[model samples]
Target: MNLNQLKLFYLAVKHQSLSHAAQELNITQPAVTKGIQRLQEYYEVPLVHKSGKNMELTRAGDNLFKIAKKIFELDKLADDCMAEFHNKGLKHIKMNASESFGAYYLPEFINRFNLKAPKVQVTLEVLSNRQVVENSINLKNDIGFVSFPVKDRKLNSIEIIKDEIVIILNPFHSLAKKKYLKASDLEGQMIIMHEQGSYFQKMIHDLLEANNVCVTMPITFSNNEAIKKAVEGGTGIAPISKKVAAKEIESGKLVALSLLSTPLYRTFYMIYHREKHISGPLKQFINLIQQ
Candidate 1:
């Protein structure tokens, strides 16, 4: 009828006597008899023969005992599996990030996380700033990284890191020699940019307008790699976060210029849905980037 009763049925069938089963199972003989009676009543069958001192099983009891043995074995296996699932730790983590950090920053951090949790599986998605916001709102990813401010009041966002947006130019460009260029000094120079709706795009547009500097119509690209390539071709100059251009700037291909009279810094955020429950794996990942 129930697991406890089934267990009693199994023990009674094993020992072949209610008194002996009661001794082995730490229950009274009446309790064992009651359990067997309940099971017999539920199935409407006789489970024992009254021919001997040690009872022998009926045909129905043989089949029922076999199943009870299997259930007990399965209970043991279930315990083992749960123990391993907990002891071995989380199996996987799904993470998302915007352009700047996704390409440059996340790989090394994820590698280090794998080292710490070797058994855990991990999938990383590189998304735009908009995608990060939308994914977090929709609870599509366990964690998301974004550069700009997110207005979703229903999400939890942590500004884990911050860095400045620097002017980028090719090595052969005239302005490449300057360590810093003020907004006023940028007048009339060709400038490629990330498309509108990007955090840096809005910031640069506002900064140039406030300082009364305007560049000629120039190429614009939606993503960073294309914009970087366009700048490297001497078509125009664009500003980007220094973290994203570390490799190119280290090499001789491109140069980074600081902005004068401007504090053009963007904060890298770790955002997730507030309603989504934080599992140990997600918490571990947040801890990894937070440090």
Candidate 2:
């Protein structure tokens, strides 16, 4: 039988009388009887009968009543879950981002979000910019954050934030004394870089190559934290987002130098599947970052 009929049948069984069931359901007794009849017809079994002026359930009716009770219980649970998501708050969110943004900036956004929704669960995956784009295009994540603008049309992207890439140097280095650094000044100087495949490394190389500035890179690390530590230890210098090295720069543990040739600025983008529906929590997160 259909769900409407099943609900009527359930109400009839709960009240134990067609007249009482109809009164409670705000329907005519004949309507209740018709609904029960439809259920019995579909199941090909007698659901109830009168015994000495009292309604009693038949053997098949007892089983059906039990099943109907479970169905309504589950339906109530589903309603409660959806109500919480729609009205009170969201329960979960999945996010993906590149290493620099995820490590340096996303945590602040998450902290702000937690202030608004303390109980909501949020998980973030730190990957490469290319990986972030792929995950967004594949709908594997609810939101993607990347350091560079994503050019793919399959994914909708918007610039969320902007950060400057500054030349990080040891305070003891000679170039650190200069207010402005020329491309030729960095020539032949030791440069600590991120892993070879990193977009930041590629940008640094491209900018330097275009300026005819070549530097030696003897150390490469997979993460910004390690590279920052390497630069602090006077191993070499690197060009990284100022946001990533903000603490070090503020603490005087790292020195930031501006390039005289061309300013290095990176714009981070938020991406998602063009057709994917953004949930409440995801939308709140986007707003938090944008703010």
Candidate 3:
């Protein structure tokens, strides 16, 4: 049977009603039934069984239905792959970035890139910073915008801009109104922290060593949003990037302070594989970042 018949069989199993499936396909019920019949004949299996105005798949039919669903999805997958293949020559760029970059930077940056290379198709993938790094050097993604430096030898990095990590505290906390505080001043303070291994975590690790002060971990979280929420609830304090605190600071949900002795700061870096050839779209994007 043809792909159309296969599609009908898949839809029939999904909806469990031949008439409903036919309605969705905008074809007659008999046409849909005929398609399923043709499919079962070709595949030598009954892919659906009806009872009490509803339908269910027999054991063998259930497996066949699952396979049929994947087959249809594969066709769509092929379409996307082919589109990428053709579009690459016409200046297509695929990028994977952290949520902050995708949410804050991509809209205007992509608009500018499109103006520079009108024919390019720019696809942006929003993921965690770690995922961006993984996709980048693994070659699944064309370019990666990461918040920290990566140590991979195959990865090339360009320092984009440095974002200061500010010491944040609850508004009513003793240190909240301070103009500046030193690293030693934070001792014994309830400092909430994100989990380890991230660049920000590494920065904190270095900061403590540089200041020769170590504060006990007050609370820990796995995500930036959770850390911010804990801080907002007056659970504890945290040192975080300016970009992460901008909205909260503006809305008066938190207070930002600088360290007098050990000022916290982190740099954002644009990274890509050194050996990977830059596509025209990615080249334009890199130029846009430089500008």
Best by lDDT: 2
Worst 10 contiguous positions by lDDT, candidate 3: 72-81
lDDT of each: 0.81, 0.84, 0.79
Arranged by lDDT with the best first, the candidates are 2, 1, 3
The list of candidate 2 runs beyond 4 A from truth reads 1-90
lDDT for residue 214 in candidate 2, whole number 0-100: 72
lDDT of 3 by residue, 1-291 (tens): 588997888888777788888999999999998988897899887767888887788887788777886576556445545665675557567788776567666677888877878887779988889899987765667788877778998689898767778888778888887898888888777788877666677788788877787787857787778888888898888988777788999999999998887676777788887766665456768888987
TM-score of 1: 0.68
Q: Give a tens-digit lDDT track for model 2, residues 158-224.
A: 8988888889999999889899888888899999888887667888889889988877888899898
Which pairs, if any, clash in model 3? none
Counting clashing residue pairs in each candidate, in order, gives 1, 0, 0
TM per model? Answer: 0.68, 0.68, 0.64
**Where's the lowest-lDDT run of ten residues in candidate 2?**
76-85
Candidate 2 TM-score, true structure as reference: 0.68
**Positional deviation of residue 181's Cα in model 3 after best superposition, in angstroms:** 1.3
lDDT of 1: 0.81
